[model samples]
Target: MKQILIAEDEPDIQELLCAYLEDAGYRTTVAGDGAQALAVFGGQPFDLVLLDLMLPGIDGFGVCEVIRRQSQVPILMLTALDGEESQLRGFGLDIDDYVTKPFSMPVLLEKIRVILRRRGLAGPESRLHYRDLSLDLDTREVLLAGRPLELTAREFELLHTFLAAPGRVFTREMLLARLWGYDFYGDERVVDSHIKNLRHKLGRNYIETVRGVGYRAAKADR
Candidate 1:
């Protein structure tokens, strides 16, 4: 069974989240503070983490940075603060997803499911490969030229999406929605930024940008 760790200070919210996750058939561990959360995480194996921005001892961002330094476990940030700046900060920390407070349990559960699905831990292999480039969805590892390529969380997701359907043109808006987890919000440049970084690491010629449409992986023969 997939395990999840939830770090929230509010007793009521903690219980609610635990119950919902359990009902979804996920094994859950709960911590009321960031310190305790890190303790639990260090002591056990968890497939994912649901973290609140506000916590006693260490803040959520601190916990996230520390955890990221050690593991690539998917992290979902839960916050009462609903500002673009706060959300951008969470993204900068490489969070997989973010949820605002006053959220519905059903929506939260759905988000959890989506993240798990995207990670390919909830199902069989969803890997894609071409030439020496290989992406293992279950292991969340990308190997290029038989050597592992270290990528940020978002970059991995974006590359995975492209490799899943090679030769298919993906508009910038589509990529932003599928990988970034939302609509344009007047910031389509985010897709360009990620693509630029991905190409820089993967290969300048790996992804082809269609002049008037979008991007597609360069054909194997071409």
Candidate 2:
């Protein structure tokens, strides 16, 4: 999974951003100020950074300068600074993209997707494999034990999600939001239905119920 560092002071926006990103399958770390952002950035590798310009200490520019000097990790500036000068300065500092406040979550997600895809950080592989199963991402084909297996679109996505992150239990709500979008008002039990179909098709050993939590991909046997 991709790791994203979010540097924002406002608690509401920080929580909102983290929830959306996590639902979309990215691991996120939060930093309330520029100093904290820098400290977190230096300690580990991250696929991307969501920066807020008006941070409490050091400021976004200072943080960007320090990070730019060390690594080329993609940075997307999320601030209320919409002026041409502010944007020009952010671009000049080598930020991959910039989004002014009051932005739509869908648009922000798309921007993150595009930036990661462009940088080759997104999952661009032709196929995904687990034990005897293989999924062709490009062709939307699945093979089981070297034989072709047919599946519905929802089943394919559910399997793909599970195979992408083995052992990551996905709640029905998370699966619904990620797969069906927030506008989906249908019963959440739809996720259970689809999972049942997938297990029927792929075999029960591939997915395991987490009892109270959700479901995760079963680990390969020794």
Candidate 3:
């Protein structure tokens, strides 16, 4: 069973998330404040974290930054802050997904399962090699002609999405749904930003844009 750390300041919300998640067959740990959340996280391993931006201390962003520095653990933020700036900031911090408050429990559960399932795909010996680029799923390590390439979690996952289906035209909307979850309702520029970054790191010739559409990794890059 995957363990989850749900950090929410409200007592009712905490119990709600905990009960629903457990009923969905996941082991859960709850933290009423950010400080307690950090402590619990440091002492134990969790498959995913449902963090709320409103907390007693060391807000969600702070905890996210700290955990990101130490591990690539998938973080799914739960915040009432629906503004684009806040959503972008969470993404910038390398969170896997962000869901605002007043979210549906069923949708939340689906998002959690999807993120954890994606995480589970990274096991020892899980790897993919295409052309001069090689990816070790377990480590989220990318290598181009044997040299390691550094990438943020989002960038890495984006790259995987393309490589996983070379030649498939993934529209911006498709990429957003696949990567950011269905609850995302912000500027589509987020996709463009990451694509630009990927092109820079993997070489401008790595991904091909289908002008007026989206992008795809040509088999030639394989």
lDDT top scorer: 2
Worst 10 residues of 3 by lDDT: 121-130
lDDT of 1: 0.80
- The list of candidate 1 runs beyond 4 A from truth reads 123-222
Q: What is the lDDT of residue 123 in candidate 2?
A: 39
In model 1, the Cα lDDT at residue 126 comes to 49
The regions of model 3 sitting more than 4 angstroms off are 121-222
Off by over 4 Å in 2: 123-222
In order of listing, the candidates' clash counts read: 0, 0, 2
Q: For candidate 2, what's the RMSD?
A: 5.9
Q: For model 2, which pairs clash? A: none
How many Å off is the CA of 179 in candidate 3? Answer: 24
Assess the local accuracy of residue 43 in candidate 1 as a C-alpha lDDT between 0 and 100.
96
Q: Who is ahead in lDDT, 2 or 3?
A: 2
Q: What are the models' TM-scores?
A: 0.55, 0.59, 0.55
lDDT of 1 by residue, 1-222 (tens): 689999999876776666545534678888989889999999988899999999899999999999999999999999989999999999999999999977755456657777988887782244667767998755678999888999998888777666656788878866664554332366888888988999999874778899889998888876
